[model samples]
Target chain A: MNIHEYQAKALFEKFGIAVPKGAAAKFPEEFDTALSQLPEGTTVVKSQIHAGGRGKGTFKSGFKGGVKLCKSKAEAKEVAGKMLGETLVTVQTGPAGRKVQTVYFTTASSIKKEYYLAILLDRATSRPVIVASTEGGVEIEKVAHETPEKIFKVFIDPAYGLADYQVRELVFKLGLNAAEQKAASKLIRGLYTLFWETDASMVEINPLITTTTDGVEALDAKVSFDDNSLYRHPEIVALRDLNEEDPKEVEASKHALSYIALDGNIACLVNGAGLAMSTMDIIKHFGGNPANFLDVGGGASREQVVAAFKIILTDPKVKGILVNIFGGIMDCNIIANGIVDAVKEVGLKLPLVVRLEGNNVVAGKETLAKSGLTITSGDSMADAAQKIVKLVA
Target chain B: MAIFVHEKTKILVQGITGSFGARHAQLSLDYGTLVVAGVTPGKGGQFFEHNGHKVPIFNSVADAAVATGATVSAIFVPPPFAADAILECSDAGLDLAVAITEGIPIRDMVRVKRAMQGKKTRLVGPNCPGLVTPGTGPKSSGGCRIGISPGYIHQKGHVGVVSRSGTLTYEAVWQLTSKGIGQSTCVGIGGDPVNGTSHLDVIKAFNDDPDTHGIIMIGEIGGTAEVEAAKWIKANVKKPVAGFIAGATAPAGRRMGHAGAIVGGTEDTAAAKIAAFKAAGIEVAVTPSDMADALIRAAKAQNVKLS
Candidate 1:
């Protein structure tokens, strides 16, 4: 649901938010053409991947990790060719890392002022709030921590839309005078339009910077759309960066793991994510390691359940598999049946511990009671995690 | 009779005739949720019966609302049609829309939310365990055996139970019923971050009811919703509110099953909510059984003697 900086900036530009003039180059040969297309002199070649921490930590000082600043077309092409099809492992890419497929060629903007602007759903207020800070570029969370009041927020009513009045308020608050207000208004409006059209959960223009020319531009753009809302926007679907994602996550999507990879080795597969995290924590509480975090969600099918089982088992280091299903909407008997089928088909040699609750627990227990699949059924989430740790240890 | 829906609150199933739709329709009718119409977009003018109440399945919520005066909708469509289904109900002006579909994208919810702006229609959740009013009767119109427990578990008195965890609510209800601590209403608002009615929204409704004397709140880790509700409980709740936060198994640094249940830091932990509620002078339960025990104790402290 996250679009690349180039695509986000392009959308920003369409709405009159000035972005560094750039084009995404898919092929190494396309780099020259793409660079020539942009106003040439000094350009920033940004590595296009889903993760962050890219420019400095990931790539070597200037010419490593596919992201390099070059003055000549030949240098840009050389860097692009080296980075193309190469898997770049950056901090943002996570421990497993993702393959670099595309790179963005952008004309570096000369900045006089750097400010941060982002809009997110504030759960406390139950409304979309626009967060703006005079200080940009660095982590906004840190800035909020150091100087909380500098980050002014304006709660937006979905009914009225983001008004020009709010933008004017922000423009003045950010210390921009008359000339800057006109351009800043355009950027805010463009972001709002893109936010609506893309069904984005977040649209952040970090470094809503001012150029030496006294004009405003969005130096970097980050837009995260709601995955559930992807059905309405097909155009955004094509920009998915699948290569730079977790293998288990990719497998989980089709197999439906509701899986979010985390640091652990116990491989907790619970019926709900809330319950799953607790299960993983309890494993650690009892001196155990969780291999990954997976949620089957409510009312999962036998196939989906089996698929989740397969995904967990795929991790070779997974010493134990914890299946904790509260069985709220889903029946415990159905879950038991799925677990039985999964053990038979997938061959569960790993130690298995389960805590199934809810409707038909008796039947579910009866089904699992007879299954001699090296499984132990606990009475509670804590008890189950404790048992899984005992078995694994 | 239930306040919003009863045996006669003309109902419409947005994906009527679909497998889940048909199954829940049969159950809902049995539980006293009067389902009057079914909509399948292309498969209108079809006839389906649940508990001998001929539910005329229409093509859309608008059409069904018009044809049968259906004022409520229970959506059982696939996750993909969730937004459209809710919007259809809101546009048709259903008093309340309960979305039973799980895995609805957050983006779709924002749009659906935008669509419901300024409207009277209130949505439950795109991924929730449908509403339950216990006994007089229930939304069993969908026949989801999950929500329909042994009617004996609830005593139909004055306890309002609200939870983010779906099945946990049923466990509490079942235990309360066995103890003869029946409820006025028990709502299982699903764990998704952008669900329609929040814990506070449901609690306010419970507060207005004269029949309700005490409240039991169940929350998991993740999101500030529970914390926000705790603040509300401290400020406005007149009745004794007993609480339990599940996800004791949730580790310190990961998102649990509910998108909102992830522990961001020590402050956002389940322990944090329990402490806040305790500081606010609300009774706290450590486990499901403890939750039942706490509610019983809370009820007794308020001196509401049950037969």
Candidate 2:
């Protein structure tokens, strides 16, 4: 759903918003070509990863910064060389961090002022809201907590879209001049249109900076589109970088399952998103760490269950497995049969705990009981977690 | 005394003949729901027969409502066209619409929510299990189900359950039903990152219903809706409320499958929600099955007897 900064800036340009002259380089060898295309000035080399806090992020190679300012093209190439292939560890990216697969070479500009602007869905109101503040280049969350007065928000009615007066009001609140206000108004309107047209969940311009040229520029952009709407935008879906994602997770998605790997000993397989979370919660409550989170969706067939089992076993850290399902429209008997068949085919070595409830539950329990496998049957959600955690411990 | 659907609630199936719609429609009709008509664009003048019972199909909700006098609609349309279906239902001036479609674009839902403003139609979910009220009269057309929640797992009782998750709703209902507790109604508001209904809406409905003496609220991480509901319950709701939140062990940033299950900060986490519930004098269940025990205690505290 999230696109890199270069892609976001390109989309911004398509929407008539101005961004610093930049080019995305996938390889360090292309760094010279990227620097040559950009405006002749001090260039900024930014490592493009999903997680933020790149300026202060450290590379696995002990390189100083994920983002660096280079006064010369040679320095730009050197910095890109350091960041192009290394894994970046920021405050947002965990210790393992993300590999720097792409880098953006942008012309560094002298900023007259920096302001934060974003369009996002306000859950409480069920409306897309435009949030702006004079303070930028720092954590907006901190500004919200400490100096709430500096932040301003305008909730745009989906029926009417963003009004011209609303944009002017935000511009006025941010203390922009007549010329800058006019320019800011245009940019805001374009950004809002882009958000609406693309079904973007969030379009953030952290530090929508005023350049020395006295014009508005989206300094650092982050655009995330609504995943549900991607079907209408095939062009956007093509922007997905599989290399940036966990391979196991990509594989799980191919099977119509949701999986997120974690550092734990217990592997959880549950139907329904909320139940999966509860399963993990109870696992931790019983003093067990879940190695991964996997949701086989409301309905799972024998093949899907086998696929899920195989994915869990792929994690060498998994000590035990827990299968929790509450079948409503989904039949519990199908789940039980799938479990038995999975263990038979995959040859499970780790202890497995399963708790089935709802439709055909009696048959489901009977099926699991007669499987003659070494799987433990849980009486309830709590019992399943306790059983799996204890067995793993 | 149920909150939404009961006897006399005529049901219509939107996107009828679609795999999900047809399957649930047949199941609901068998379970005793009064299904009067089906609507699929260009499939008008057709008859969808199941179990020797024929349902007349209409081109639009407007024509269907006019012909069948259907007041409620359960939608199983695909996500891309779901918003338009909801708008059509609302436009037809239906009493309630249970949207079973998931993955509706937020932008589309934003427009849908706006279109629903001040409208007669009350929208339940875009990604939910739907609403159910048990104990309708046999002659009544409103069946045992309005959504995907199993009809067999419920019994007519005093507890009203409203949840944000689909399967978790069934789990709680199963626990209560197995323990001899019955439900007046159950609603899943869906897990969309931004939805049409909220915990507050369902809780307020339960609060006003005389049949619902105790309430079960199931929430998860990611939104302040639960905390807000707790505050509202403390001030207005007189019935004993039992609460449970999923994702207590979930880490930050990772969305637990549900679009709305991402922990935004420390505030929306399970610990914060449970603390809010306890602070509001509601019984908090540590586990899903513990909901039965909590509900029993809640009902007992209010001098409401089970059985």
Candidate 3:
């Protein structure tokens, strides 16, 4: 659901929010052409990745920063050459880091001041909250924790939309000048529109800077859309970069299975989200690390279960597999039959433990017992988790 | 006495003609719930005949309520129209509207929640398993089964259960049932960030119901609803309360299948919630399987009888 900085800035421009004019290049050959589009000035070369902390990130090629301020067009092109196709490791991007597939070149702005601005749902109020702060270009959480008074929030009424007064209040709180205030108000309005119209989960601009000319602009844009509402906005969905995601996760999504890989040996397959999460928790509690979190959903059909098994087995680190189903409306017999068929198809050798309960549980257990597969059946979730952990150990 | 539903509660189904809705409708009918009406916007004047029970279908929630005298509605409309379905129930002034549909846009729910501010209807979920009050018959057959939960897993007794996840709720209920413990009512408030009801709402309801002696509250990472409910239980309620928080192993910023189940900040993490629960004197289940036993431990410490 997260889009790169360049993609977000493109969206910002489409929504009438001012962003520094930028062009992206996928190859070193395109770097000069991309730099040519920008006005002759100090250009900013940013490595395109989905994670934050890009400016402080280090590339695998021993290049200093993922984001660089080049003095000339040639320098920007050189920086872009160093970044493209290089892996960037940031605080957000784990140790493996994300490979830079694109590099963005933009006209660097002369900042008079920086302010933090974001729009997201405040879960407590169930309303969109505009979070702004005088302290910008840094982690907002750090600011909120250190100088709590610097942060200001304005919750907007979804029914009436964002009010003019709310924008004015944010502008005043950020201490914008008369010229900057007008621009900030308009920018905030546009940002909210982009957030609501595109079904964005969050729209954040770190260091929303005011140039020497008193014109306000989003210096850094981070926008993520709601996955559920993606159906309504095909344009937004088109921005999704499959390269940034794990291949197994992408494959799981294609199969309608919820899969998140972790660095462990015990793979967990559960029926629901909460159960899947807790299945991981219980594994850790019982002194076993979870390899992945996979939820087969309510209907765990034969094909879906088989697909889930295939996805889980892709992780060679997975030493054992645990199938936990608290099938309320789901037929346990169907799940058991699916497991039996999946095991035969995949020819699984790792220790497999299953705990099936609820509707038609007796038949389900009987099916597992008669499958001619060496599957361990546990009496409860605790028992099943213990069995798998022991088997893996 | 159950908090929201009982044996006498008349239930209506929205989008009953759909496969998902019809399937659960048949299950509810099999469980002996009084499924009085179905609403499918132009499927009016038709009957949803299942197991010899010919439930009438209406064009609108208003007509359905008027014709069938239904007080509650279980919504199974698709995400795009689910919010509108909830709004229809609110306009018709139904007592409760349990939205069983998932994947509703947060924007729509925000507007729906705001529009229903002072309305008569109490919304349970836009992505939930709904509520169940177990019957006294075999496998608890005759009780009010509003949503998609398996009725046979429940037993009519004194313990009250509330959870964010559907299967986890069933896990806790099954654990209790296996221990010969019965529940007064079990409610799933859904796992969306912006749901109709909160843990605090259900906790307060359970606290007021005299028949509900012990409580099992199941929550996950993300949001402070569980913390709020735990704090309230510490202050006002004398009932024995046991709590379990999932997603302890969930990495931060990752959405754990559920739209709402994400570790956002320091305050909403599982560790923070568990600490809050412990601070409020609520027994915390170390694992999901220990949920029923944790409640029993709480009940024993408080000299309270749960069934």
Q: Of the candidates shown, which would achieve the greatest TM-score relative to the real structure?
A: 3
TM-score per model over all chains: 0.85, 0.97, 0.99
Pick by DockQ: 1 or 3, better one: 3
- Ranking of candidates on TM-score, top first: 3, 2, 1
Which residue pairs in candidate 3 collide?
Answer: none
Candidate 1 lDDT tens digits, B1-307: 3334433456677777888778767766665555677888887887887556887877778888888888878888888777888888888888988887877876567657876878999888756666666553332222222222333234555677888776567666766765667677777787777778888888888878776777888888767677778888889987888887876655554445565665655567777887888876688875555667787787678776532
Q: By DockQ thresholds, what CAPRI class is model 1?
A: acceptable
lDDT tens readout by residue for model 2, B26-68: 9888877888999999999999899978999999999999999
Between candidates 2 and 3, which one is better according to DockQ? 3
lDDT of 2 by residue, A1-393 (tens): 889999999999999998889998998778878888976668899999998999998998898788899997778888888888799999998898999999999988789999999998888898888999999988998998999999999999888988888987999999998778888999999999999998888899998998766799999999988878999999999988888788899999999999999899999998889888888888888899989889998887888899999999999999999998888777889878889999999999889999888778899999998999988999898888888988988
Ranking by DockQ: 3, 2, 1
Name model 3 segments beyond 4 Å from true.
Answer: none
Compared with the true structure, model 3 gives a TM-score of 0.99
Look at candidate 2 and tell me the lDDT of residue A378: 95
Distance from true position, residue B270, model 3, in Å? Answer: 0.1
Give the Cα-based TM-score of candidate 2 against the true structure.
Answer: 0.97
Reference-based lDDT, residue A312, model 2: 94
